[model samples]
Target: MTDIYRKLYTSSMMPSINLPKHYNYIGAFLSLSCNLSCSYCINHLVGLDQRRKHLSGAEWVEGLNRIQTEGPLPISLQGGEPSIHKGFIEILNGLRKDLNVDLLTNLQFDPHKFMDLVDPERFKRDLPYPSIRVSYHPETMDLAETVNKVKILHDNGYSIGLFTVAHPDALEYIPAAEQACEENGILFKTKEFLGEHNGKLHGTYHYEGSVFSKEVKTVNCKTSELLISPEGHIYRCHHDLYNKITPVGHILDPKFQIDDIFRECTYFGKCNPCDVKRKNNRFQNFGHCSVEIQDIE
Candidate 1:
C-alpha cells in the first residue's frame, strides 16, 4: 500500500504538469496539545473547542516521505508544541535523510534526551535560519531556564535560536531577554505581534477588514504554504485548520495533489491573522502574504 501511494504521489502529484505547485513552506502539526497556554496563542484565535485527532508516527513517515521538493525546502515540525507529540523522536528519525528537517519548539523538553536520541546532522540544512527555532514566551516560560536549554542544544551541535513575539504585555521583558540571548551568544529575534491587544490590532495585514471583523464575506483565495493537520488532512489556510473546516486533501490519499488555483471562500472577515498578516517571504522581502484573497464581498 505504501509503495502504491508513493508511485501515485510521484507520478501525479510531484510533476508540475498536473498540479500547479508553488509551495515555499510545508508545516506539519504533529499535535495541537501544548503544555503552556499563552494568552495570546494564535491557535486559539478562532477558539479551541475542536480537538484534532493525530496520526501515528509510522503514518506520518509514510505520508511525508511522498513529498518531493526542490532546493532547501524542508518539512517544518510544529504545533501547540511539537515535542509534546508522543512519537516526536520517532517521526524525526523516520523521515527520509534527503528531506531537510526544521523544528519549532518552546524549549520545554529535555535537551539531554533529545541529543541522545537524535543526531545533530539530521537537522543540518543550508538554510538562512537555524533548523531549530525556540519560541520564548514570557507569560508562561521562565526566561533564564529557556536560555539555558537553548545554550545546551547549541553546545551539543544543534542549530538553534530564540524568537519572542513582541506582544503589548510582553514588550517590557523582550529587551532584557534579547540582551540575555546576545550575552550568551544565541541569536535572538523579535516577531511582530498579531491579533487585537487593548483595542488595537498589532500586525500589518494585506487585506482590509479581513481579520477581527464579526461579519463573514465571500472571496477567492489561494495559499503558498502546505499546512497539514495532525490527522494528515491538508488545509487551505490556518483558519480552516483551526476551525475544523473541510480539507483540500489528505497526505495518505494516492490521488491527492495540490491545486494551486484560487478557490472561493465565504469566511473572509473571520480569517486567521497568520494568513492575512504582511510578512517576509523566503527571500526575506517584506509584504508577502501567505494567502492571496480577491473579490471581497
Candidate 2:
C-alpha cells in the first residue's frame, strides 16, 4: 500500500484502549524472529511458538494507533530482533508522532539505512534511559563492531545505549565490553541474567515457585502493562505470550476494552521472569513487578 493511503486509512478505524491507573508499560512486539540464537535466550526460558504469524506493518500501525496512554508513555517495540520485520522501517514511520516509541535491538540492522530514512527526533524523549537500547550478547556479537554502530548512531543525534546481560558463563567478558564502551564515551549498562544457567535459576523473583516451579498451580493475576504479541494478540504476561496462551483480545477487536481486573491463571509456576522480577516501577521505585500474582497453591 502507498504511504499516503496507509496513513489516511489507518488514522481513525478503532476505539482507543486506555491504560489502567497503575499501568507502567506497553510492549509492542513487532516480530519474534532474530538473527542470533543465544543459548541463554530468555524468550526460550519456558517455551516459545516460533510459528506464530507477525502482523504486517500496515496492520500494526492501524491497531497500535488506537492506544491512548495516561502520560508520555512509549510503546516499546521489541522482539527476537524487531529489526528483522520486513516492514520495520515502515512501522517506525507510520506511528502517531505524539505517541512515543522505544526500541530494543541487537544492533543487527544497518545504521546508515536507519539514519537515512528515520528522523532522530522520532525517538528522542526526556527520560532517564535512552529510547533505543542495543542488547549486546557476548556469545553472538562482536563487541567492537557493536560499539562502532552505537558511535555511528549516537553521533548522528540518536539517543542510544548499549546493554549486556551478566550471564554466569559470560561474566568475564562483560567487564571489558563495558570498559570499551566507557572509554569511547558510549553509554553502557548491565542487566541481570533472567533465566537459568547450569542447574539453578539466576534472578530474583517477586513470587516464590514462579520460575521453574516443580508443580503447576492456579492463581489470580493482574497486570499493569499491555503486552501485544507479533500477531497483535494481547497477553496478560510474558509467560502467556511465549507459551501461546489464549489472549484476552486482539488490538483490532473493535469491542475490546481494558478490564483492569484480576484474571485466573493456571500456569502460575511457569511465569516468565520479566513479569515477576522485582524491579523499578515507572517512578524508579525498587519493589515493582509487572504482574500482581495472588492465591498460589
Error of 1 at 160 (Å): 0.8
lDDT of each: 0.86, 0.86
- Error (Å) of candidate 2 at residue 101 is 0.4
* Top TM-score hit: 2
Q: Residues 1-297, candidate 1, lDDT per residue (tens digit)?
A: 445566656533532212234567789989888888999998877554367678888778777877778677788999978898888998999988988999999988889999999999999998778899999999999999999999999988999999999999999999889999999999999999999988998789999999999889999999988888888889999999888797998878776788888999999998999899998776567888999898886
What TM-score, to 2 decimals, does candidate 1 have? 0.92
Give a tens-digit lDDT track for model 2, residues 62-176: 8788889877788899987888888888989999998989999998888998999999998977668889999999998999999999999998999899999989988999889
* Residue-level lDDT for 277 in candidate 2: 96
TM-score for predicted model 2 compared with the true structure: 0.94
What is the lDDT, from 0 to 100, of the residue 51 in candidate 2? 85
Residue 242 of model 1, lDDT score: 84
Q: Report residue 295 deviation for candidate 2 (angstroms).
A: 1.5
